[model samples]
Target: MASLTLPRHTGFFSGSLPTRPTLRYAAPVKVRMSLSESGPSIAVVGVTGAVGQEFLSVLSDRDFPYRSIKMLASKRSAGRRLTFEGNEYVVEELTAESFGGVDIALFSAGGSISKEFGPIAAEKGTIVVDNSSAFRMDEKVPLVIPEVNPEAMHGIKLGTGKGALIANPNCSTIICLMAATPLHRHAKVLRMVVSTYQAASGAGAAAMEELEQQTREVLEGRPPTCKIFKQQYAFNIFSHNASVLSNGYNEEEMKMVKETRKIWNDKDVKVTATCIRVPVMRAHAESVNLQFESPLHEDTARDILKNAPGVVVIDDRKANHFPTPLEVSNKDDVAVGRIRQDLSQDGNKGLDIFVCGDQIRKGAALNAVQIAEMLL
Candidate 1:
């Protein structure tokens, strides 16, 4: 994620003026790697969506090595111009021929698009890192969180002349597991419960815009616009918009439950989640409760998390400062705090924690880029 506050653009090249600027992180060190002619060829599917735009941002921020890059979107967005790595490129309509010479394709388009083109691209021997629910649970597709389970995609690599589909876990699952997995590694998690306060970004750029627009309209004594969602989003919270399943859990909550089990490779691990949409602009916050197989003290858990890669402990009981969505916005590291023993569980076998992460960045683009980096 770029440290500088950037214009909230629909795509890399298009932008709408913001009535209220969202705060983002400033990178302490920016790694600038020049694109090498010998590097892997890259293509970004859904190049006009929010996460698609973010894909470009993360690649540049991390200085990902790429021999060439193509911006791909629907026919509507094709012929558009965008700038990346100090070069101007015209967006091309994604087609069967798009992946011909591409080595790695980062996909953030909706599930339908991914389902159709993901396999087609991979069939061409382009490693497709798909950010959708399409192939997440597919036995053939490796649902990956690079920090948690890079091994899931171990044998699959670039230049194998073999294309494979890799699924990026749901943003909520990615955020929660980033904090819980470290502790799980120390003491096996027998069961896990998660409550998410997701932001509008998870719904796409339109939801974010609706949130902003609704806020202004509500403040002005007008009926809030409800295009992206069914209800007012400015000052109210509601159950996530995902369809409610017969089992009573919405799709978002189930994603957390199922993805956790898959990523952990522990089908027996019990998991449950309640997902809610809050009025935050970006980033998702999670409250996680864990029951471990053996005892793990809160201090030990804290220390483990502090040393964990892609995790930062922000617990400050004295100051009452803990992880907040705003604090983690546009930041790569997931922030974990509110570390304490679960009073409901006996002994030190259980703990509770709060986590926050930029859904678009670490929860999506940054994670995908990290997976691509492993290929090199």
Candidate 2:
């Protein structure tokens, strides 16, 4: 018989957001409030994309206070209709002029779009919480994961502060940190080795659609579509499609290393990662190996994760069940499992674990909203 150990966690962790948050849509927005009426005037910069759609869902789920909200996208998407907060909205083409009178602009457009307009929005006094890599590495721009580093963005708030930009870390980085940070706080991680199984959703809605179309085509004995990826992605796994750096690490992998360093505000920690895009539709999974400066027992680690905010423990050894992307889809909390001490290192100084989270929700939109909430 296989060894089976139920998570059996004792308590919850602090310094985190709500766990298992529901993502149901809000009732149709009955009335449209004006920017001058009350609450903050908001803008969704990439209102038609995947993460963009998620931003709307999260905003409604949390009942984020807004006197008005603008759905801004590319020229092509202008005039398209989207419903939110019980109200119907026509998408507007984002431009230099869109940020006027907007209080908080949630940006989910591609890097180029964010690169151009993020600064513009900030210059116009609109606080921009950008969900792209565009400004994450900018020293002056505070990269934030509200659960882990809210203070990194201290002094900025809605309605009362000068316009500034805050960068949301990559989805993989966010999900990993949600689980790892609690443990790191206790054990002081000295080195980290991560292997990721990413989902098509990380690529974009097009990539996700391609996967679905290709899967159907493959089942029907047709040639699989290969539009979004260089290779068939429906039922096959491949290395992350990000450009390879001189160090042989892909951009996605490098983001894990660099972002972890910045978010933790710890420059001396050693980290490495190998990222692969699996056929999963929505969430990302990671196998994280850690070497800690202090001893951390496996049982104690489980208890810490159990109590940690925004972390769900699913380590079921008897049933051989653990965190899966399917279970975490559209969920707010990151699920952690496979916790065990690394026998390779003496003195209980190392351990291994698995983590999964919805790339679009906690990894992107929900996270951005959480940071925005802290400012209020």
Candidate 3:
């Protein structure tokens, strides 16, 4: 596999690990790795995938205190060399016995892999932060977005000598709710309509590479490759590739709808979504139309969002600048803009907002890491 160029300083290995990826936003302070014999013992499942690489980046950037860390991936990726925090480790083949001493296992290997090994790890007392839809809708599993509902997984902690599963919500759902939850708390959301403009990163590294390749091939006047997506991905937009259900909503669309209800714990809240895949390389932008139970002045909503954790209000009508996928590509905070009262609905009761967030970082790796942080 050819190396895929990722954002600078993110510490992701494209195909092989030759040099460590640099850090863009980490503090000047030297990050301490396994130097000390304290903190949770960590394991990253699917260490060769995009999100797997990101897990290392976030952990290092945040200076997460981990006494020891193991990189686990599929058999094909096993024995590959990767470096994190100045230490080189060989990727290990993931198996039922891999989680013997792992206190926290971050799983992003897809639903099938997660289903097979997630419980096996948890049963061995590892706190599994699964980034798959496999367990998100499970009533027993806590679908968590750290900023929105830390309380949902309240008592889950490391060293319990017991295992648990915490599901990360869909990327679009996380980006949407990061901006919407603040306003929801202020005025109580009655209904939410979300339309996602997602990027190739949401589809994984191969898709990103395919998009880049297609773009190049098209510009070179050659036939574009269409392996990742059946249709041309370069300079094109298409409905999300998730399989459509009997209800006519694809899996991606329904993920947002159902995840919002689960994350918000508001089964009564009406939610609808339409997901689309755009040509952007990273980050996801969402157009949210919200109807509140009580009137929430646009100005008040903006103020509320400005103070929301993990959210940044970028509404600057005078400049005509709003949250763009490129602006939030590798950043942590979800950016919000286009904040205004919805003219289609009653005054101060409905508002429209645009939000952008890095689907790979905050959506998957960072959110799961944040959940791990709460365990401490």
lDDT of 1 by residue, 229-310 (tens): 9988998999999999999999999998889989999999999999999999889999999999999999999999999999
What is the descending TM-score order? 1, 3, 2
Against the true structure, candidate 2 reaches a TM-score of 0.90
TM-score result, candidate 3 = 0.93
- Please state every model's RMSD to the true fold in angstroms: 3.4, 9.7, 3.3
* Model 3 Cα lDDT, one tens digit per residue, 1-376: 2333433334544343223323132222233564458788999998778788788878888888888899998887777676577776888889998999899999999999999999999999999999999999999999999899998897788888989999999999999999999999989999999989999989887887788789889989999989989999999999999999999999999998889988999899999999999998888999999999999999999999999999998988899988898889778999999999999887689999999999899999999999999998
The list of candidate 2 runs beyond 4 A from truth reads: 1-37
Residues 32-102 of candidate 2: C-alpha lDDT, one tens digit per residue: 33224567888999877778878876777676788788889898777766555545677889999998998
Error of 1 at 204 (Å): 0.8
User: Any idea what lDDT model 1 has?
Assistant: 0.88
> TM-score for each prediction?
0.94, 0.90, 0.93
